[model samples]
Target: MSFINYATREIQLKIVYYGCGLCGKTTNLQVIHEMLADESKGKLTSLATNQDRTLFFDFMPLVAEAIKGFSTKFQMYTVPGQVMYNLTRRLVLKGVDGVVFTADSQWDKMEENVESFNNLIENLSLQGDSIDKVPYVIQYNKMDLPSVAPVNYLEFLLNNRGVRHPSIIASAKTGEGVLETLNLVTRLVLNNFIKTQTGRSPAEKKNLVLM
Candidate 1:
């Protein structure tokens, strides 16, 4: 979650990118690292398997000036997509402030996507977090591919599984929808952060943070 320091007037948050194997989770981070101004981002650390799939995680820290004397920073991460790395994935998600689920849109990976999504929920539970209560977003990746699952179908599955978080259509390779997804999640995470820190009622916090 976002950390708002009344003394320093700073807000720091962790945003995690999660998905199944080869679902473009790492690609999303690469795109951000490339697009952001060098001065705004920090060192990126990545651990990969022999085949180059994510092994541990990819982490990049970004800082942005906030309005009204408040500063905001985000430490972005990508969980290893392979199931063998489940332990690693679980480790990275601890204390995450926000989540972006990058689902592989390819039709053939439908089952894997569903299973991975379920894993996200299970893992979050292990961390003492409820998926319904977290600040999260879904990214349907590889939208440019012809064989990808239909948007409507994916939406239906997500809804049925109680994954009602906001979603974005994206092709990480081309950088489409990347910034929009980030902006949406950042705003939601910040709003949640402010609410928890100030101890505002849910409705009051929602209204104030959205403003």
Candidate 2:
């Protein structure tokens, strides 16, 4: 988790980007890092194989403006997408507060996307967390490609698995929907953190919606 200590307030959160190989997880990070104001971000560390390939993980810390007296900090990370890097992927997911699953939209990669998503769920379970309990978002990446899957088809597949997480259509290369996805997941995670820390169960919070 990332921590922020400024005077009387403190906040911490960890968000991880997960997806299949070449699904643009790293590209998302690169774009965010470049887009943030210099004062709002720190050096990005990319630990790669052979110093040229992003084979392990990439970490970047961002300090967002204070919100209602609390400073929010995000420790964003990207997991290696290769199946052989399963151990590395699990390690990066440790202590994650939020997840952004970037799914490749290509028709040929449909099965791979499904498998990788299930793997993420299984890994979360092993870490004592479930997909249903975590603040997660989905990014249907590569939307600019002509051969990409239909957005409705993707949403239907996700909903079939009992996941109601918010999904966004994104093209990392063009900076479309990246910040929107990030903002949505960040808001969800922070709001959930506040509720839980204040001893409010998620179900209780939902019930109060009618009041």
Candidate 3:
């Protein structure tokens, strides 16, 4: 759920990036944090192991355009992806409004990708949140790697859900598709909020869509 502060005229949405260990979830956040103007982003905070793998989560707060009279802020997070950190992953997902599932594209990591996705479903269910209802986008990352799987194959493996959510092919290291993935998820989250709060149709709220 999104937090709305009328007195402060602000709205904060939480977006979590989830995937297997070393799947570029942190890289996506790092790229966004570095590219964005300092005024538009908060300090990038990371709790990582000595080897630099995320131990808990990476947090980056970003300010977007105002919606109605409220300033829209997105608190971006990346869950620790190692299997042993399942508890930490669930804790990070407590109140996410949107998600970006970053899948490792290397062929060797296919099984890990599927396992992490199943873990995601289980955690969301435990929190009483259905994956189908959440605003999310799948990102096949590490595309620049030579051993990456084909996009079509990855889609069948990870995105063959009842409804196909938006998916993007990305190389987080090179910054490809990072912003596109972020923009799409953010739009979905805002659109959902508009529909629920105002009972407005897509046509009625078309103008408010982020470009």
Number of the top lDDT candidate: 3
Q: Could you tell me which 10 consecutive residues in candidate 2 have the lowest summed lDDT?
A: 156-165
Q: Which stretches of candidate 1 lie over 4 Å from their true place?
A: 4-8, 161-163, 201-211
Q: Candidate 1, 111: how far from true, in Å?
A: 0.5
Q: Across residues 67-133, which tens digit of lDDT does each residue of candidate 3 receive?
A: 7788999999999999999999999999889999999999999999999999999999999999998
Give the clashing residue pairs of candidate 3, or none.
Answer: none
Q: Report the Cα lDDT for residue 41, model 2.
A: 88
Q: All candidates' TM-scores?
A: 0.90, 0.89, 0.95
State the lDDT of candidate 1 residue by residue for 1-211, as single tens digits.
4566889887788999988999998888889889989988898888887788888899999888743587788999999888888888889999899999898888898889889989999999998998888888889999999998888998887646544678899999999989888889988887787667667755795677899
Clashing pairs for model 2 are none
Candidate 2, 106-210: lDDT as tens digits: 999888888899999999999998888788899999999999879899987654665477889999999999989889988888877866676785668778996
TM-score of 3: 0.95
